[model samples]
Target: MDFALVGLIASLILLMVLALKGMDLLIAAPICALVVALSNGLPIFATQEQGDIANYSDSYLGGFSQFLKVWFLVFLTGALYGKLMEYSGGAKSIAHWIIEHVGMKRAVTAVVLATGILTYGGVSAFIAAFAVYPLAASLFKQADLPHRFIPAALALGSVTFTMTSAGSMEIQNWLPAPYLGTTPYAAWQVSLFTALAMAAIGIYWLNRMIHTAYQQGERFILPQASIIASVEAEQQQNVNPLTAVLSLLAVFITAFLFHQDYSNNALVIALVAGCVVLVVGYWRQLSQHFTKVGSEGALGALIAGANTSAVVGFGSVVKATPAFAFAVDAVTAIPGSPLVSAAIAVTVIAGITGSASGGQTIALPILGPIYLDAGANPEHLHRTISLSSGVLDSLPHNGYVVTLIRAICGESHQSAYLALAKMTMVVPGICTVLALYFLA
Candidate 1:
């Protein structure tokens, strides 16, 4: 790759490091993007390069706007949906039902699995963690489980929610072509498979950790209320169980219809149906929740999307021009069997976006075409790649991880890293290895 392309790669790494170091994502992303822009000599668009340097600022602004458009509706609707659920007693009601059925012994596991399932319903982990943590914290405390387990449980829950949630309208999942183009229907099937794999692995790991903690009586490591207490008190409600379930069912029905014709947006239809259910079930009560959903959801979604918006935009800009094209080619040029190449592509792309969705966006666009060109099974390759993307996305540096850790645990720096590692490293590793074995 050329020096400029190499610099673009280096800048991306630096951006992650900055995020890990507690830099604001908005600042870090733009700075990193600017660095990439300067390094790659990207001046907004291609036409401007041959023209003048005066258009550099315009390019940056234009790129920023493009990212905003992608993140705005996706994150807004998703976030609002969560907020609405919070206000309407939907999430809590679900958690309460789960606890009532599973009993405290299995509460943590139940919460994680349930969150994963709900994510498939277009729920973001940000909303899931907030919605579930209070209920989970109360149950974990009653069970005399370690306090640390609360945040850990929450982190695990978010991973499943964000990674493979059923009808997710997450920009990374729904809108982005790079992520699903190579796989198509693979999103649905693999989404389910990954949820199961992640849950099994997460359960095994959680049990192992708890067992070890109890055996050693490592009281220091267990979750404390202090970790997630603030979030619980300040929590918002959205949709009740009846609404969430009915809404979700409508989504399933719509999805079936969508299968008959691929042009419809599953998320838009699902959320709309869900909102209808909410309104129908509890008119005035639902109206009260709408404001909470609008404000909180918008804020939360904006927070998450801002970091990614700039990063995705800048990354796309860098990838588009000749300056960073060499880096793109170089990654694909790595020598391996097509299968191995596919796997590497999945892992690499996932790591790039620090998100499963993002990975799909970055890698799938490029990787999908390559895999298709190489004549790989579109379903298998796409599923494999999509699932693998979740691995790195669960890492502490990832936007979702940091957002939940900070929001739930109320800790920063290294406090949540342990919980993050439990989900991101141990859990995802187990799942990924199993997938590799199965796919192999």
Candidate 2:
């Protein structure tokens, strides 16, 4: 038995377990990195090797630093954008406007569309969930829709179609660019079709599930009276819906105009533009909370950036191990289209890691070189891996799923997760398969 391989596998398992147990990734990731280092016989500090030093700190921090170097701005701006939208009453205004226009008859659709718009505009999904939840709850309550389905509607809008689709400002869509030398608009033709498919099928399935639950006599259950009052209080903010729409459009327009010229950096510019729009557009509404919101947004960005960086650090350690090399060899050796192999490898690793970004961070460094050398289309490969990453990464144990269902929505997985799974996992998985068939 290869003890080193065993340690790698063990570390991966522990990472997932710790994450699912609500442990901070900052602590869990480093501990797991130490495990892989010890098992693989790496030096804890530094060692002289062929006129250079080989050390665990270098490898671990190297990956962490590299990710931050490349993505810190994006993360910072994205969080601030989300925060401005939230604190300025812009996000709520948008939600209320959509609900009003769509009407109570299609309350779920309104909530989902609201979330989709925010997420596609580059707001963090977590922030989008929190910002939209109050509106979603009120809508469901008014429509007599089951409250348990709230997470599903939010997750569907935030993660499935808009998140992975071409031209999205999400990091998942942008992460592959530097590695593949492709723009965020990679394979956009196929992405448009796949996104439409996911939207149509996922929305239909989600509505069907809600309708089924309603038919079975399930209806919205009011939360504790205190919780209701808190939610209602949160939803009482007033802001002009038109200004909010323009704030969102500022992000979309800036990104659209600059993406071709600036690539991923366009997102930073776009988010900044959006923030300025919100601040100016809703100055009176946000004046009291401006300082607080900016500080909170910065703090949120730090936490999110650190979490992703920690996992990337773990991947850095994994990359230096013999086990990772062997695994890479095995994956690349699979007999089939390189796109198919890339998709399978990325999706499986994403499922295991419980993070699409983490999985792609680990796999792309190895697969990018191999596939590009094998004459694969860089644009197609980018789209394939991005779409595939979203599929299995939404497993029950995933951090995002847990946060959305339990932490944010205050609902148990037993009731909410079925709808969540259909919209996120199943829908994305089907789209990934179809993407391979059509793009390959």
Candidate 3:
């Protein structure tokens, strides 16, 4: 009935059509943005200034610019580091190590756990998935784990939850950049306790799915269970282990350097640092896998990063909602209880976006201000909201889950909803209980 409600509904309908019809986002997003703009009585081409090659973006262009201004460098830096890891066999090495060391049965669990740790350290989810997925799939098959669990582990490990918690080196949390007009550093922080609690929720959810599969007799097949043994049978590569070790350390070193406050541009640091390691340790080996490694790395980035970029763009679009002011107004209306306001605000924004990053885009900008005005620790508020985005966006049907299901197991949308239910409702419930405890 209401105009704002209609625009919102239309936007949602577009997302559904895109999903069901296999429409491209480049087409879907602009079309949807136009609809929202027109429905809200805003001109689609308000940029007719001076008639000089007029630009055609809603006010969202301004928001998008701001989003990019803050995040582009971070993303590029992340991408570069990710690219280097791929070049050095670092990513494959990590994946292989997890499978061989953890074994098939426990590998799924280990990979998921590793993702959480890396995510909490501020790596991008795109990088995490790329780094882990190839190996995780083989691990899944051997453990009799469902192939679908590959994406599940990667997404859960990377995207939602403590992975985005404030103070995490992970880019997802910081993608919101300036929340409520405050710099990212202003958000309070993600406590170790909160992170542990969030991680517990994730582990429990995965285990529950495992039990369900056990009951269902779901088929499990590990395609590369013998990869490591076979490779070793041919003799370890002449490339020294030290080379691989340092290449892997690139990520760890970068995370350590930025641990004090996550302001540094990770891409530049990772690249320069990774390059040095690759040169000194196994520079020659680079040629051995040149074309193959280069392509695989980019493929990883493209697959994971493409979806991420869209969600990033969507955040830009929604931030321009005519009702954005109204949304901010509503968040400000919460009286007396700051904690309740934070919980509700984070949940709504995160749920709507199907992206923890997008939720921060909407919620942090508005709610961050409210909390600051109320004298809440800016960092704390930021961190809590960031953490909130992860839990809220864990819906089974979200892009992350969808990608996981399709990539690993050929699951149709219907089959993956069970994991979504477990994570969205069950995991968040546990996290919420703990959140209240922490706040009190």
Candidate 4:
């Protein structure tokens, strides 16, 4: 391997290590980007004397700015939209409804199903986690299942099949459409099978793990008093389940109807419409909490957008290096269907970046033309990249996984990550391979 490539790989590893340590990406990303710049002989900053040289400002910040330019609105509206569903009791309403219908006898199944529904329905995965968790805790306690598996159940629902499925409200599903000139429903036939296989296999594995824990005499542990109190408070605000479902439908139906001409703009419109529905549904309560909701939502959007862009900046710096060109050549030269090469390239970048959107945003710009020029089906590439992005992007460093395990569930990685890995990484990985075979 070339020395620059070695440096690139080492920088990525360092970034992952920093992520696992729970350092803020806003800080970690730039530090690692500097490493890539220095090691690759890129300039630290472009000056008047060296106006055209790739540097941290031109490369890293340029990448970062471009991501925000393109995606800030999506993140902004997505966060506010999720917050509306959350604050107006829409998400909780749906969670309660699912739990009521599914019954507590199958606690693990209920959590997974509820989370999947909320996520697929256009609620942010973070919001869905918060909404369902109170219900999930109560269910697990009542059903006598161990609490450690809650993160896994959430991951299985939020990130695996639901996140990558055709027409999913997830950004991952939408990211490839613009790049490949395909819709989110690209290759619907293969995506349908991939999603079903992922869900069926994941549900089975989650249940089997719970059963084993039961056989070992494991039982649910009580959560903190504050956690219990929050659940009770959440139960107090009971928005109608129908209202909740409508809010979700607004996003999905509008996006589906408009995605062809508007592309990702459809998502922005859909999210705004969803927010409007929730605001109307909960107008009375909005008087009390409207400002707080907007502020919090915007803040959340800022954080999420900045975090993704930081990683994208790192990708930007890496992209300027000769090593990146070399790596791309090697990946594209792989002797197989262009779909196979696309999958490998997308998955590898997603894994390295610890972000699906960040990875696809970086790789697709370069790889999309290559595969399309080679006569690969744009729809196939869209589906392949979408599914592949979900695969290794869930390593322990992934922001969503880290948040779910530690921030939401209050469980350490050592206790919860094994189950999460199985759901997010292993199951999706198997389904991705199956997708490649079918698409091939």
RMSD of 3: 4.9
Candidate rank order under lDDT: 4, 2, 1, 3
TM-score of 4: 0.96
Task: Estimate TM-scores for all models.
Answer: 0.83, 0.93, 0.79, 0.96
Q: 248 in model 2: Cα distance from truth in Å? A: 2.4
Which should have the higher lDDT, number 1 or number 4?
4
Q: Which of candidates 2 and 4 is the stronger one according to lDDT?
A: 4
Q: Where does candidate 4 clash, by residue pair? A: none
Tens-digit per-residue lDDT, 1-440, candidate 1: 37676767787688779878778766776677677777766664446346654334555566567667645665666676666666777767776667667887886677775565566666677667776777776666666666566567777766643554334444444433334353134546545666577777777778787777768765433234344444345334444467667765665566546633453245555566666665676566676566666777778878867766655655555555565455557666767545456666656656655656555555656667776787766556655665566666655457766666665655564655675576765676566556555554
Per-residue lDDT of 336 in model 3: 59
Writing each residue's lDDT as its tens digit, candidate 2 over 1-440 gives 29989998898888877876778888888899889988988777875553345557888899899888888999999988888888877887887778778988887788889999888878899988888888888888888989999999999899988888888889999889889998888999999999889988887888888899899999988554212446567667587878777867888889888877887899899999988988898888788997888799899999889888887888788788787777778888989899998998898778756678877988888789989998899999999999999998887657678888878888877778888988899999999999999888
- Candidate 4 local lDDT, 1-440, one digit each (tens): 47888889999899888888999999999899888888888889888988798887788899999999998999999999888887777888888888888998877778888999988877889999988988888888778898999989988889888899998989999998888889999999898898899988988899999999989999987545223555445555456878778888898999989998899989999999988888888887566888888899999999999999998998999889888889999999999799999999999999888899889999999999999999898999899999999988888778888888888888888888999899998999999999989887
Best by lDDT: 4
**Candidate 4 Cα RMSD after full superposition onto the native fold (Å):** 1.6
User: lDDT of each model, Cα atoms only?
Assistant: 0.61, 0.85, 0.57, 0.88
* Poorest 10 consecutive residues by lDDT, candidate 2: 222-231
lDDT of 3 by residue, 1-440 (tens): 27876786667667656744556554565566666666666555644563532122734455545555565555554555556555555555555555566666666467776566545543456556655665665556556666545555666566656465545556655554544433334334335565566566676668677768868987654333222323223222233345545654675576456534554454346545655676566566565765654566556545444554555455555556666557656766778557567867777666655666666665666666667777765555655565566666755336655555554335555655567456544565566556655553
Can you tell me which runs of candidate 3 are displaced by over 4 Å?
Answer: 47-56, 117-123, 165-167, 175-190, 221-271, 288-317, 394-399, 424-429
Error of 3 at 238 (Å): 8.6
Ranking by TM-score: 4, 2, 1, 3
